[model samples]
Target: MDKKEISHSELKALIGKSPDLLLIDVRTKEEVDKGKIPGSIHMPVDSVDRDLALDPAAFQAKFGVQKPSLDAPELVFHCQMGRRGALAVEKAQALGFTKARNYAGGYKEWSEKAGK
Candidate 1:
């Protein structure tokens, strides 16, 4: 149950190397409309707790994506800033996502450093 804080550079490298990583964006729909990390799944922070409670198959169907197994290598979450990301990581881990991590440098920082 390690909730690590992933740095911007580390996240970028991860994106390049780990296709299995589950990148969850916890930003609002309005905020997300501006732009988001290329492959991130949109799961706003407010909905995380509820969504994590759904059965795996149901969750996957609802999200239109594969549900991360409990032992999935990495389940990273992020928002406009780091706060919601951290919370989402906690919620994911609580729901048994062993490799949950927060991308502390969220969309704002990502856009600033990684040019979106």
Candidate 2:
């Protein structure tokens, strides 16, 4: 239970309820084509370090989601399992997204827990 990690149940509750929150899914294009958590913006893990450095407008145009501010409280990242998501969090924080968090259970737990 890392302080910067959110559980599936917590993420489910945050969806739609937290207007300031951004759900980021860092997975391969092919993997995401299968499915992702509803409302998640797809930004691949490899591109995170590059893309997150973009200015706000450019970031939004690229990712179709608002570029999270450096300190945005609910910038949550997830992947197939937990590892890549955690890596994404590290990248985000390195770029000053200090509050970025990992959905450590990732999509597998999310799908299973939600019976998707």
Candidate 3:
């Protein structure tokens, strides 16, 4: 599926802006246990399809914010690096979200920024 991918800097800027700007971390809880970017929601890529199928609303609510209020949510998906994030972004777009973006550098970039 086609998607609009955003860089790390672009994503950092987009955070806390509006409606359904969701920060979706595609790493496992164990990985996240190491640390996660503040305000990010955990939704491992493996479970996304099933979870979305069972209860899209609940999944979206806990992990996503509705864009423009109950409208399409902007998604920023990340992983250890960028591979999984790209997959997640594709999945999100297939699910009908128009604003999904892949955080190509993922947590590594996040950690680097935090160090700075």
Q: How would you encode candidate 1's per-residue C-alpha lDDT over 1-116 as one tens digit per residue?
A: 35478888878888858878789999999999999998898998999988877888998888877888887877889998899999998888888877888999899998997653
Question: 5, model 1: CA deviation in Å?
Answer: 0.9
User: Residue by residue across 19-82, what tens digits does model 3's lDDT show?
Assistant: 4467778999999999997778888999766554546577557656432222345667889889
Best by lDDT: 2
Worst 10 residues of 2 by lDDT: 1-10
Local distance difference test values of all predictions, in order: 0.86, 0.91, 0.73
Model 1 Cα displacement at 35 (Å)? 0.7
Worst 10 residues of 3 by lDDT: 65-74
C-alpha TM-scores of all predictions: 0.89, 0.94, 0.79
Q: Which stretches of candidate 3 lie over 4 Å from their true place?
A: 1-3, 54-57, 60-73
Off by over 4 Å in 2: none
Q: Rank order by lDDT, top first?
A: 2, 1, 3
